[model samples]
Target: MNTATGEIHELWEIREEDDPRRSYAFGGRHGQFSFARIMAMLAKDSGITGDDFRVFFYCGIMTYEEGGATAKEAAEFLGLTPQATRRITKKLAEHKMLLVAEIIGRTIKYRASPHIISALSGRQQSEQAAAFHLPTLPGRSGSATKGRTNDTSRPVPRTHRPAGTDERTAAPETEHTDDVRDPGRPGARRRTHRG
Candidate 1:
């Protein structure tokens, strides 16, 4: 503390290497997720449970990083029985959130839908999409503008802007939006809402 005036200081070294507000893993990059599908999967009407979410994302993580995996391998890491893993994978596949890629011996490999989770860059995903002949996945429901009819979004109050983004002159608040690609699905046409 300064004896003459009250002040607080923090060191540059104190900054966190990874931003805690966003999710990142071994690659130190943001992992993509489909807002529409995620909300749908978690909705009461979707019949997906927390366990389903776990298993689905686990397969995506493995697929994004290591191509793909069998239920047995995922089970070992996720601490579930191989049977349970298989069942979850089956359910997720039926939901179109996962796919049966291939089989080697008696094990079936699974890949997550590009709309759900992806680690590949947009171009990489595009190549995989063509090679895999994967269908372009639907993102948010309805047309871009049509979906926002309820206007669930609210403009950020001026007082709450992030530290580095403060503006000097008064400006009108507009709906701030960003479009994130649906992994490898090249033809996706919906806009995702972000705060």
Candidate 2:
């Protein structure tokens, strides 16, 4: 310690062999994508829903050097119904955003389009997707539970009428005239005023 000067110096500094900018994304690691194109596809009338985006991301991230995942795989990994997952995957594939990497028996695997995302180490490029559990928000995939809860804390309507105001005072009452000239029954009044 320098008691007189009293100054702190860096313990150590990091050195890099390659430029950080040189890396596509995530420090030049895998799972990179073209943001511009993806945003365009997600615009209105794109026919792609948020669910489709979710599945697409999952398949893309899971794309291995030589293989990709099927709709079933995506559904399992994303906690979505297989049918819903299939719908999303098919829609993306039809739009040419995803490529049919291969077909095993009746199962069709998908890869991210090279333009959309580069495989982590996969020989093939493809439509991209990601992993990690997402909250079951209210959207394409409806909530599993009824989600109906009685919230008594909510702001209650103004049940208490203001002082000096009743139905008649609050809202002006319209008076109806009776035809006394007509020789009808004593109580047979056509119109009457409400209290």
Candidate 3:
């Protein structure tokens, strides 16, 4: 299974559950744009980490579905502190990936940038979108078509085994024994022997 090419072949055909409910498939153009292109773009961008990409994607989706999203709302959705969310938003804003849509009193609303929206809409990649080159991460050669493999044939170092465990033997039994004390019973104090 090569992850680089993203080509997958299901060897065994699994029968679907006998539920009468209809399953929805979000794919074709939109799915490719959202999951494939946008995610890769976000991952490659030096300014955005994986977490930052998640927050950004959430913000974009929320904005598209529910008009707009605030930093507090984004923080709540991402389970992050408001300050942390603000920092992510600030970075996105600096990179022109996020746009301030409106400001009502103290609350500031944000939406995905025009470039992002255009790209996600299946339009040609804008100059801003093309600027980000996919990073050459470890174990990956930055070639999307190439399948990832263990390039180095170096043997993995062995570590010391824990006490009472042998590599050749099966794991120790977890069954109850006479020496084991039952803590669930009333007055089940362990007797400390005075040596």
**lDDT score of model 3?**
0.60
lDDT agreement with native, every candidate:
0.67, 0.63, 0.60
| TM-scores for every predicted model | 0.50, 0.46, 0.43
**Which pairs of residues collide in model 1?**
none
Candidate number with the higher TM-score (2 or 3)? 2
In order, how many clashes per candidate?
0, 16, 0
Residue 133, candidate 1: how far off, in angstroms? 9.3
C-alpha lDDT (0 to 100) for residue 79 of candidate 2: 93
User: After best superposition, candidate 3 residue 42: deviation in angstroms?
Assistant: 4.1
Two-way TM-score contest, 1 vs 3, winner:
1
lDDT of 2 by residue, 110-188 (tens): 9766667774444433212333112222222332222321222543445567777665645645445643333566645
* Ordering by lDDT: 1, 2, 3
Displacement of residue 101 (Cα, Å) in model 2 is 1.0
Q: lDDT of model 3 at residue 27?
A: 48
lDDT of 2 at 134: 20
